[model samples]
Target chain A: MAIPFSYSLRNLWTRRLTTVLTASGMALVVFVFAATLMLAEGLRKTLVETGSYDNVVVIRKSANSEVQSGVDRAQASIIESQPEVARGTDGRLLLAKELVVLINIPKRESNKPANVVIRGISPASLLLRPQVRLSEGRMPRPGSAEVIAGKSIARRFKGGGIGETLRFGMRDWTVVGIFDAGTTGFSSEIWGDVDQLMQAFRRPAYSSVSFKLQDVTAFDQFKKRVEGDPRLTVEAKRETRYYEDQSEAMAKFLRIMGITLTVIFSLGAVIGAMITMYAAVANRVVEIGTLRALGFQKMSILAAFVMESLLLGLLGGVAGLSGASFMQLITISTMNWQTFSELAFSFTLTLDILWKSLLFSVGMGFVGGVLPAFRAARMNIVEALRSS
Target chain B: MGMGNGKPPIVEIAHLSKSYRRGSQTIPVLEDITFDIADGEFLALMGPSGSGKSTLLNLIAGIDKADEGTIRVGGVDITSLSERELAAWRAANVGFIFQFYNLMPVLTAFENVELPLLLTGLSRNERREHVELALQLVGLSDRVDHYPAQLSGGQQQRVAIARAVVSDPAILVADEPTGDLDRVSAGEILQLMDRLVREFDKTIIMVTHDPRAAEKARIIRHLEKGILTDSDGQPASPVAGS
Candidate 1:
């Protein structure tokens, strides 16, 4: 016969101090677990959400990221003129030659300059990413000494917000606007006209040319056509896959770090739980004997104690998750290892993370409580009764 | 001789011997002991510390196994039952109480009484009614919501008694039920036990060192050094001979 659930709950409540202490320990473990997942989530979201599935990036052969790749303007033109490229309403192919670089910018808070990503793009860049919208002021005019800062970057660095003037190389450029990229990776960069940025940085070649495809199905044909030609030695990749690859290493590192830390912390927490549960069983020797005498099977006694520990775990899980949710309000700026530049991200605690954390807490409880419960169940009833 | 024409006693013990092994040597705790209890008979087991009164209780309650011999309770050979079967059998037929008033500290008085009923297949409403009736029988209806720590020692023992009889078992085995109480509280508990035997027709077997507690029983058996004797210290007929 099944014991009522209240039996477990009441057992935990009767020893409220031990329950809270063990729960808090488990809460700390869960907090670390959830934080690791969130870090991985942030990294993946930063890269995967930055590009479209239908868009293709043309980079130099053997080049991995845009910062390491360069293609001549002539190559960019040739790629734009390909028949497989999608055409706009104006009867011209939709494409843009872009430049990406990392430059140091002073922070408003600490005045210590940090490396921030700078992107150079033509007018068609905005059309390619329709989600990008100006939030505070006007877009920078083409061929002007003006720039637009992503909302996150503008909030962190000095002279980054609209109407503020910032220096790069040897010339001063004004922050003409503040823009948002609808949660894409571009939301962490500063944008300027491609030609002006190229000239100011003394670079004659474009980093890469990104173009929209007719459809996803046409990708194979386009790839075969481009790679078959002897004249162009470049690689074509779907924009989404390219960005996803960029974030893979960072995400894996975060996941490993998170899991390792959670395991270590859980070991300590489980030991704490074991000690607390053992103490409870030891103190309740007579009670357990009486339970046995009252026709409670040994298995029921085991289950009762295990269930009490699980309840403690659940309480800890809720506390840790709720505490982690508050991290969303603060912005954390860290180096994107792939690009070697700082990117701002927030703690995105989704529903899946919360539930997974709770499950982890429960697993810890089971691991911690089982041995003591077994000992309690195996106790001699007569001896226990005599223990008065 | 066995009781009445060829009907077996409700409880029968034959050559029931139990010993505790200390290293290689066996120290006998209950040696060649035998007895029978008829249906609805109240028997008191009285003994000194080393006399095995509690061991006898433990063996009968299925909490411990005898080293030798057979024990039949309610016409079933309990010594041969598996641990799992014995637990179920105890739930159906045996109720137990202790001197320490071992109520679960977490549950209220009412919930403590309802614990045994959880083993039955009764529905929630039925369980509630039975638990209420048992608490009312113990006169602890007013303390139903109180936890063990909140109740007095006497009240706690009452809750324990309520728990023991809640499932309406065939036998109630109490080990020093009044051992931890004052004279007044002890009297209350004894009076309750007497009422269970007189009015409810429950067969009770109690183990106690207190002669005053044993005087209330219909019959008293004494044990010394694993040997059973009558009140006058005469050798009683072996249960196997009966």
Candidate 2:
């Protein structure tokens, strides 16, 4: 028969000081492990949400990102003429021949130069990406040296707020509007008129051609046509898939670094749990013997100790998750490896992360408690009672 | 010897032997011990230190195994039972009282008394009723929620007694149940044990060094150097103090 659950809980309470100390060690390790996973999840979420499934991007076949791809005017026109491209209410094709480039800008707080994405767009750009809404100020006038800064850029970079002027590409540009791209990578970019930006930067061709599909299901056929066209050296990818690829390398690095650090820290926490449980067993030899004499089996004693350790782990898991949850409130910036530009995002905590963390904490408790529990179970009842 | 009520002995032990090995030295603790305890009998074992009184008590309690022998309690051959079966048998048949009481410090008196019942299939309310009845019998109903540390030494021993009788086991083995208590508390504890036998018909086997404690038992047997003897150090009779 199993021992009462209250027995294990009360024993932990009786030794509250050691219980707290050991649980705190486990809590710290869990915090680090969970925080790392949250950070990676945030980055992946921001990038993945930046694109829409219905939109397709046409880039040079050998290029990995928009900034590295080039599409000439002829190729852009050919892509826009496809029968599968959607038409706007005004009978114009819903397509944007965009130029993507990176420019160094001083951060508002640190005044340190950081690479920021500068996307030059046609009139249909904002229409195609409905997530980017003009939150404040007016849209930039076409054919003028005026730019709209994303909310993150407006708040974090110098000369990025509305009406501020930034000098770049041997010309001055005015920040005319602030756009909000909720939790997406576009929040870290600046947009302006395509022709004006191309002229200012002396670019020879458009970086990419993006258009909404007339029917989302036709994406495969459209992709096949675009990839097989002999006159074009371009590849077609759904915008969502393209952005997902962008987050892969950086997210993988963060997860690896997080796991390595968590593994090392968890070892120390496990050892701490081991020592605490061992001491508990040592202190309760007589009590264990008394229980045995009262008809409790050896397995019951083992289960009691293990149950106590699991309680300890659960305590740590809760504390650690509480600490990690606060990270979502603070937005942090890091370099996006694929585009070599600054991307700002907040830590994101999902149900998946929550369950995984709790399971991990309980697992630590099991690993730490098993051996000590065995020692308690294997003790001879006579010897244990005699020791007291 | 004739049992007072003409009932057969509740416990029958024959040729029981036990020894310990300490780094290649074999020290015998009990040899060829044969004994019988009547139903509802109060028996006490007294001896000098290392005289095997405690060992003999442990063997009867089923906490220790003999190297060779047969012990039949309640008509079942306990010596032939496996370790697991013996544990189950002990749980169903024997209760224990220690000198120090040995109550779980973390548990209140009520919870401590409720421990053995946790192994049974008794419902929670049923268990509570039994525990409350036991506490009332020991006159500690008001102290049911008090921890061991919160109670006096004598009160703790009373709680221990209540726990021993809570399950109504056939046998109760006490090892120096009053060794750690004062004379007043010890007398109270011995009186309680006597009451259990007189009123509840529990067969008790106790090991003690105090002659006063032995005087409380109806039957007193002494052991010397791993052998049972009389108060005069003569070989023990098949049954003493009948």
Candidate 3:
């Protein structure tokens, strides 16, 4: 018969101070691990949700991002007239020929220079991005110098609020409105009329052409037909896929950083667990001897100690995960590695991250307690009884 | 009282020897010791320090192995069993009471007594019944929820005795059971041991230096220089005049 589990539980409870101290150390490491994972997931969710599955974005072949891609006016028209393009309520193709450029801005608090994305959107662009809503003020007028700032941009950068004007590229652009794009990358951008932006910047081409497919399954056939056209020197891709690719580099960097920090911190937690377990073994020599004399086998003693450590890890996992879930209330912004422009997001918690964090904590406890448990099991009953 | 079951001895130890190695030197503890303890007999092993009396009791309890000869307890040659087998055998056969009342400090009197029964296949209710009976036998039934530290020395010893006999083992081995107690506690513990054998018919092998403690046993023997002797301190005489 196996030893009762209460034996291990009561033993740990009896040494409450050391148990709490060791569990807290493990909790710190788990907190770092969980927080980093949440941060990366948040960045990925923001960018991935910025695009739609049924939409196809046409960009210049071999270009890394929309900012670096360009299509002539004729190519944009041809791409918009495709048979697979979905028609809007106005009987026009649901397509937007857009331009993107990066400009330097100074923050209100830090006064430090940061890159902000300035998006020049066609008339159909607002209809295509349903997630973007005008929270305050009005939309920018077409074919005018009136621009609108995203909620994040208005809050962070100078001259980015309604009725403010910013001078750049030898022209004064007035901010006529503020729009909110909930939990998406568009919240970091400033939008204006595409034709006015093109004329002001003296650009003869559009950065990208995005059109919604009539049917989700038609995306493959539409992409092949558009990219197969000899007059078009551009490639087609799903907008969602494109945004996901954009987040790949930053998300990967965050995940690797989280793993590295957690690995380093876990070493300290494991050592703390080992020290606490060793102390328990040392103090309970007589108890172990008494158990052995009561006919408990060596393996029983080993299992009891291991169970104690595992319980400690589980407690730490719960504490750390609770602390990390509170971070969702905090919003953070960083420069998108792919676009080199500001991207705003929040820390997110998911069921997958929760389970993985718990598993990792349990693994640490197993590693820390194995040797001490072995020491406990290998004790000689005759000698151990003599110690006390 | 002349006591023999008119059958094979419950504990038969013959030509048993044991030694310990320290650094490169071999120190002999027990040498060529032989003894027979009858069924339902309460025997006391008396000796000075380093006389190997505790070691002999441990051998009889199956917690230690002999270097030579055999120990046949309850018609089984326990010396031939492996460590795993011996642990199972001891769990079913030997009960241990210690000098310091080796009850688990974290457990209540009831839980401590229930420890051995956990090794059995008894249901939870059945185990509780057994624990209750054991505590009642030791007159500690009212202190069932009391932890070892909360009880007085004598109460603690009674709890230990309850835990030892709770499993209904074939034999009991106590190493200086009252060595750490006051006079009143010690006398009470001795009386409890006497009652265990007299009423429960358990075979007991107790090691102690106290003459008063030995006087409660049906037979008393002495060990000197790793050898067992008869009651008159003579060499190699049969107990119960066998």
Candidate 4:
């Protein structure tokens, strides 16, 4: 004979205070778990979605990121003249020499200084990234001391939005525009005319040169041709792969942190569930005895209690995931380890992350409830019946 | 009345001896007891504290194992049955009532009554019908939806009785059923037990310290120390003192 599900449900409901308290504690653990995964997901999305697979970036030999690489104008010109480089509508190579540097800027509320990446890009750079769009104002003119800030940066730094002025190295630059890069890494950078920025910062060489290849298949040939020439000691890689490699160390660090914290938090939640289930069994001794006397198998009693705990865990998982989804409303700024500059990212709650969090919650419930359920099943009917 | 055909007794016990091990010594509880209960016989077991009356009832109810014995209940050798088999047999043939009316506090009267039926092969609708009939028999039809906490002690005991009889087991074993109730409640409980035994024709074996409660049974057996003595209107040697 089967025990009705309503019996377990009603029993849980009868102890509403304990049920809710245990569930909420589990919810807090799940929330932290989901948030950590979202942080990792946001980091991955920022790097993976920022560049195209067909586009190739040329940098100085042995350099990993644009901030560490420097290519002179002559070398940039030589790379742009390659036969495998794609041509724009103007019948010229689709190549851009860009500058990447970091400057310390004051935060909006606390006035505490944070390092922010300032990118100097040519007009061709805008053509290279069609996803970039100005959300607030017009793009700055070529020769003017004006800059456009990424949407995320605009929210984090003082004098970052349109119409504000920011001082950088004794020169005041006007914030003329605000742009969005569709939630990618570019959303954390500041853009201006390459030549003007290079003059202001006294940088003679560009950080890196980016260009679209004639055919993705020609990438290997292009890399071979560029590296084979000792006259130009350079490295060429697909921009997407480049950004992927750049994010690997940080992604690994985030994954470790997420898993470690989730384990710790899940331990606390499991302990909470154990305490609640133990109390439930203790209080329902007579009820269990009646069940035994009524001929319910010990396995059934164990299964029923474990199922109740699982239901509670599932409730907590749903709540935590729902709360994490709302975190997209906030914008966070943290220093990018590779560039030592603040990179703005938002919380992302993907379906995969939500499902994983739910599975984790259920596991916690099962692990925590088993001992108590065993104790309940092993109770002596006579002793249990005698219990007040 | 139809005993001329020599049908097997519903309950049979032979040389049943039960003891508990206390440290290094074996303390005997029921020493070489023998008894038989015919089908539909309303028997009561009366004894003082430490008289092994409840222990005998537990052994017959399949809740405990005897140290040495053969116990046949409803024509099945219960003493030889495994723990799992005994539980199934008990579910099908034996009903139990405790002193405190141990109804699940979270369940309503109807759900509590429906519990034993869950161990049966009956469908939900059939279970509902049986539960309804049982509750009706106990006069708790109006209190089916009320929790145990909301009912009086007597009503709770009635619900317990309904639960015990819901599965329609062949025999019922009650231990101090009215021990926790007041005089009026106890009287009502005794009357209900009498109706079950007379109308339902159930083989009832009850343990009680109250002689008034025992008076409702057709035959009352007394236990002193660990020995059983017949007290069914017949002269018997005084136990232990003789």
Candidate 5:
């Protein structure tokens, strides 16, 4: 027959100091574990939300990012002339042959220089991304030196406020507006007229050409046609697929970092739990013997000890998760590893992360408790009773 | 053979031997011991320190396996049973009382008494009733909620006794039940044990070093240097003709 759960519970309560200390160790490890996963999840969410599925991006075949790709004006025109490209309300092609470049901007608080993306857009560029909206002031005028700063850049970068002037490519540009891109990577960029930027930077080739599809389902045919054309040296990709690829390297790095930190920290926590459990077994040898004589099987004793450790782990898990949930209130920035541009996002906690962290803590507890529990269960009843 | 009530004995041991190995030395603790105790008999095993009396008691209670022998308690050969079966059999038939009370310090007196009943398939209410009755029998009904540390030494032993008999097992084995108690508490514990024999008709096998404690038993068997002896200190094989 199994021992009552109350037995294990009270035993833990009886040693409250050790219980708290061990649980606190586990809590710290779980906190780091959960926070790292949240960081990775937030990064992935920001990049993924930056793109719309119906839009396609055409870049140089071997280029990994827009900053590295170049599409000449002729190629941009050919892509824009495709029959599958959508038309705007003004009967103009719903496409933007954009130029992307990076410049060092000093952070407002630290004055530390960080790489920020400078995107020069056509008039249709803002229309293609419906998620972006002017939260303050007005949009940048076409073919002018005026620029619009994303909300993140406006808040974090020096000379990024409305009406402020920023010097790049030997010309002063005015920040006319601040646009919020709602958790998307676009919020980390500065947008201006493509022709003006191209003249200032002396660039002859557009970095990439983006176009909305008239029919989303015809994307496969359009991609095959673009890739097969002898005149085109570009590859076409759905915007969503492009952004998802952008998130892959950064997400993988975050996961590896989280696993490494959690492993190192959890080793210490598990050892702490092991010490606590071994002490409990040593102190309760006589009690175990008495239980054995009273008819509790070895399995029952093993289960009781393991249950106690699992409870300890559950306590830590809940505490760590609560600590991590509050991290959603914090917005932090880090360099996007793939694009080398500063991106801002908050820690995002999902139901999946919650359950996985809890399961991880409980697994740590099991590893810590099993050996000591075996020692307790495998004790000789005669020798144990005689210990007293 | 039928010393107590002329009925069949509840516990029978034959050719029982046990030893311990210490760095290649085989130290015999119990050797070829044979004995029997009739139903409702209160038997005490008395000896000096290191005389192996407790080992014999453990064997009879099915808490320890014999090296080369058979032990039949309540007509079932316990030595023939596997470890799992022995555990179930012990739960169903054998109760144990320890010298230091061995009460779980974190549990209340009522909870301590309720432990053995948890192994049974009794419902919660049924277990509570059984626990209350056992506490009432031990005169600890007023202190049922008190932890072991809150109770006196004598009260703790009484609680231990209630725990032992709560399941109504066929045999109760106590090792020096009063060895850790004061004289007055020891006297009280002995009187309670004697009452269990006359009133509850329990078959008890107790191992103690106290002569006064042995005097309370219906029959006292002596053990010296791993061998059973009569009162006159001679090697005795009285019951099983071994």
Candidate 6:
């Protein structure tokens, strides 16, 4: 007959100090694992959330990012005139012909220069992306030199605050507004008047054209039409797919790095668990013999010890995940490999991450406990009872 | 061999033998030891240290295997049973008591007694009733919630006895049940074992070196040099008590 479940649980409780010490070691590994996963997830979420599913982004066929794309006025106009393009409330096409470039900026604290994205946009830019909201002051007017900074840029960079003037493009540009783009890539950019920026930089075509589609499902036909058009040398892609592509390289790198670090650290954690379990078996020899004499079979003894280790994993998982959740409040900045710009994002915790981390912890416990549990099960009852 | 009462033996051993190997040296522990324990009998096997008394007890309890014989207990040849089947048989038919009063320190007296019943198909309420009755029989019903450390030596041994009998197994095997106890506590334990045979009709086989412990049993035997010491290889008569 199988031993009762409480037998294992109470045995763990009886060795409270060992349980805490071993669990804490496991908790440290889980914390590293969960935090690394959260970093990758956060970076991916920031970029993927920047795009709308029903919107299509038109860019140069050879360009991988908006900064690398170029659309001349003729090409922009031809793309905007498509019948499948959604119209705005004012009866104008809901299209934005934007120009994107890279500029170096100094941080407020470290004073180290970093590459930042400077985007020149039309009035339809705000109309296309509904996620961006003006948190302070007003949007920059058309045909003016005023620019707006994202909330992240305003908080971290020098001369990025509202009403401050930043010298860029050989001209003094006033930061008139500060906008918040919740957990999206746009929060790492500076936006200004497209015409003024083009004139200031000189000899530049639009970087890309983004527009809302009339029917989301018509994207296949629209992509074929745009790619087939002789007058245009551009490709049409869903904005969601575009942003997802932008997030892919950096997210993959983060996940690989995270997994490597966690794998190395988990070895130590698993070893710690093994030592703890072996010690437990050594200490409970007589108790195990008594149990055997009481007619608990070898399998029951094995299961009881394994259950104790599993409980350790359970406690460790909860502790590690609890620690990772607090990381959501910390915003960190790093270089984005896709666009060669500084991007800021928080460590985000998701339901999938939660479950996977917990399972990983339990897996560590299982691997760590198996050998010791076998030792416990294979013990001779005579010897076990003989040991006081 | 049949006993005088004509009641079939609860534990029957014929030509039983066992040996141990210590790093390439074969040490015989019990050789050609044979006996039969009848129903409702209290028997004791006594010897000095390292005389195989405990090994003999363990063999009859199905905790160890015998090399050269057949042991039929409750009409089944236990010597032929597989390890897994022996485990099941031991759970169903054997109860055990140990010298150190090996109650689980983490479990309360009541919980410790309720342990063996967890293997049975008995419901929770039924198990509780059985555990309560066992504790009551040991006259420690009030100590059910107490931990083993909180109880005295005699009380702890009584708790162990309660745990042993809680499952109502066919036979109870005890190894040095009073070896760690004071004389007063040991006497109390012997009286309790005697009461179990008289009142609950339990069949008990205890291994010890104490003459007072052997006197409590109806039939007593001696072991020496891995063999039974009686010339005819039968149990000697019960010792006259002081």
Candidate maximizing TM-score:
2
lDDT by residue (A1-388, candidate 3, tens digit) is: 7777888888889989888889999999999999999999999999999998888889999777888899999999898788888989989878899999899989877989899988899877888889999988898877778999999999999989889997666899999999999989999999999999998888899999998888889988887887788998998889999999999999999999999999999999999999998998999999998888889899998999899889888888888899999999999999898999999999999999999999988878888888899999999888888887
Question: What TM-score did chain B of candidate 2 earn?
Answer: 0.96
Per-residue lDDT for B164 in model 5? 92
Clashing pairs in 3: none
Candidate 4 lDDT for residue A352:
94
> What class would a CAPRI assessor give candidate 2's docking?
high
Error of 6 at B194 (Å): 0.7
Correct interface contacts retained, every candidate: 0.82, 0.74, 0.56, 0.54, 0.92, 0.68
What TM-score does each of the candidates earn? 0.96, 0.99, 0.97, 0.93, 0.96, 0.96
* lDDT tens per residue, model 4, A1-388: 6567787788789888988888888888888888878887787778878888888999999998899999998888888789888888998678888999889899898999998888999777877888888899889899999999998878878999889988895699999999989877898889988889999999999999999888889999999989898778789989999888877778778878989988998899999999998988888888787787778888888988898788878877888888888987876767778878777777888899989999988888888889999999888876777685
Model 4 alpha-carbon drift over 4 Å, by segment: A216-221, B1-8, B232-242
| Better candidate by lDDT, 4 or 5 | 5
**Backbone clashes in each candidate structure, one number apiece?**
0, 0, 0, 0, 0, 0
The collision pairs in model 5 are none
lDDT of 6 by residue, A247-278 (tens): 89988888898889888888888898999999
User: Candidate 1 vs candidate 6: which has greater DockQ?
Assistant: 1
Candidate 2 residue A291 C-alpha distance from true site, Å: 1.0
lDDT of each: 0.86, 0.92, 0.89, 0.85, 0.91, 0.89
CA lDDT, candidate 3, residue A52: 87
Q: Is candidate 3 or candidate 6 better by TM-score?
A: 3
DockQ top scorer: 5
TM-score of 3: 0.97
Query: What is the TM-score, restricted to chain A, for candidate 5?
Result: 0.98
Model 4 lDDT on a 0 to 1 scale: 0.85
